[model samples]
Target: MSIKTTTLCALLGLLAPAAAIAQDSTASTLSRLLECKLTAAEVAAFTDRINAEDVQDFAHAGSDASGDAALSLWKSDAPVTAWGETSDLVHLSSTTEMLLAFKVTPGQELARGKAIVDRIGGMAPRPDQAAMEATYGWKGMDFRKPLSDNRNVRVLVDLSYSPGWVTVGCAYGDIQ
Candidate 1:
C-alpha cells in the first residue's frame, strides 16, 4: 500500500478498537447500574445517613408512593443531615430495575439523577415492557411514543422479556 493509505489504515485500525471499547464500557456501565448491587463499602458510603425506618418502609412497601413519602420527609424543613435510601434495586426476569431517591442539595442531586436516567432511557428499546411483564414472566409490551409532557424525576424501569437483556423502559417524574 502507498504511504498515505498505510497511515490511514493504521489510524482506522486504532480508532476501530477504541470505538468498540467505548461502546462496551457504556454497555457495561448500564448493566452494572441495572444490577444495582452495592458493595459493603459503597453501601456504607452512599447510605450511611439513610434512616433505618425509611429503609424498612421501602423494603416492605416496594412502591413508588412509599418512595415519595420517604423523599418528602427527607426533604422537609428540618435539616437533612443524611441521604435517604437513594435506590431500591429490584431484579425481575433477567433484568434489574432501580428505584432511586436523592436528598436534593441545591437541586443538583435531582438534576444529576434525572440526567443519568434520561441517558439510560434513551438507550432502552422501544415499545417498552411493563414491570408486571418482567416480574410475572408475562409477554412484553410495545410502548407508544413517550408522552411529551411525561417528565418525572422518579425512575420507572422495565426490562425486556424477549431479548431478556435489554432495558425496555425508564420513566421519571418529580416526586408528587
Candidate 2:
C-alpha cells in the first residue's frame, strides 16, 4: 500500500480489469496455512492426520541432533514410518521452518500429495507445473508459501523419492 505502488495501481487501473488486480496471488500466500508454534501433541495430530508416526520410538538417538537449537515441535533424527511400515528418516523438521515427508501407500503419491495441500488450502495455481511434474515417474515436488502475505514468513513442501520408483514419501516445509 505504499504511495508509489498506489500511484502505479491507479495508473494501471484504467488499462486493466479489476479482476486482474484481484488475481495477483503468489506462492507466499501459502505461508498463512501453516500451524505456527507446532507442539508435540499438535505434531502428533499432524502426523496422525497424515497417518505417519515420525520416529516416535527413536526420536532422540545417538547424540544431540538439534545441536542446542531448542526444538519446539517434534524431535530431530526421528525414524518416520510411511503407512506404518519401513521406518525412515524424519520428513517433518522441528523449527520455525519445516518440511514433512509424508508417508503414503503404493501409487498414492498424487492423491496423497494433493490431500496434504488441500488440508492446508489448495495450492496456488490450482493445477500447475507441479501437477505435470507429478505425472512423470517422480511423484515428488517442492514449493514455498510465505506467511502474512510476506515473503519473509515462508513455508515449503518437498516430495522426496526417486524417479520411476514407487516409494512412500511426500515432503512439506516452512521456508526459512
Candidate 3:
C-alpha cells in the first residue's frame, strides 16, 4: 500500500474502539520496530513530554489489582541497579493498563502483574516467553534489556533495553 494509504488507515484506526486502536497501534509499531533500546533521557525525549502522573502510574492496565501492585513496585525507591532508568517504560498503547517490565528486579513486578491478569483472564505464561531469557540471559534481560521479565506471559520484553533484548506487551493484550 502507498504511504498515504497506510497513514489514512492508521488515522481511521483512531475511530475504532479505544481498546482496539491502542492494541493495533501498539502491535504494529512494535512489530515494525522489532527491537528498540533507549536511555531514560532518550525515552523521555522520544515519548515527548512525559507528565509526573505518568511516572506515578508507570505500567498501568485498567483497574486490575495486579497493575496496582505493579505500580507500587514502580513507585518503590528501588534504585535501578542497571535499568535504563525508573523500571518505568513509556508505551504507545491507548489502554491505561500497559506495563513495561521493570529491570530493577527480575519478575518482581511481572509476577504480581500476572497474578492480576490471572484473576481477570486465567491465562498462564506461555513457553514462547522464554525466548527473551535464551537470547538475553535473565541478568541481561532485566538489567540490560528494555524489559525485565521471566518470559511467563504475553508481555513483550523486547520494547527497550540497555544492552540486552526484550519484548514488551500491553496488559490484557499483546503488543509483540
User: What C-alpha root-mean-square deviation, in Å, does candidate 2 show against the real structure?
Assistant: 20.1
Lowest lDDT 10-residue stretch of candidate 3: 76-85
Q: What is the lDDT of candidate 1?
A: 0.33
Clashing pairs in 1: 127-143, 152-172, 152-173, 152-174, 153-173, 153-174, 154-173
User: Which one is best on TM-score?
Assistant: 2
State the lDDT of candidate 3 residue by residue for 1-116, as single tens digits.
99999999998787656655554444333232223322333334323423334332223333232232223212211221111122323343433222343442444544544433
Q: Write the per-residue lDDT of candidate 2 for residues 1-176, one digit (tens) a residue.
A: 99999999898886565434322211111112133333334434544533354322323222243222222223332233332223222323332333323234546655554554455452443235466566764334433333342322122222343221122222234332
Candidates ranked, most accurate by TM-score first: 2, 1, 3
Rank ordering of all candidates by lDDT, starting from the highest: 3, 2, 1
Cα deviation at 63, candidate 1, in Å, is 26
> Where is model 1 more than 4 Å wrong at Cα?
38-176
Q: What TM-score, over all chains together, does every model reach?
A: 0.27, 0.32, 0.25
TM-score of 3: 0.25
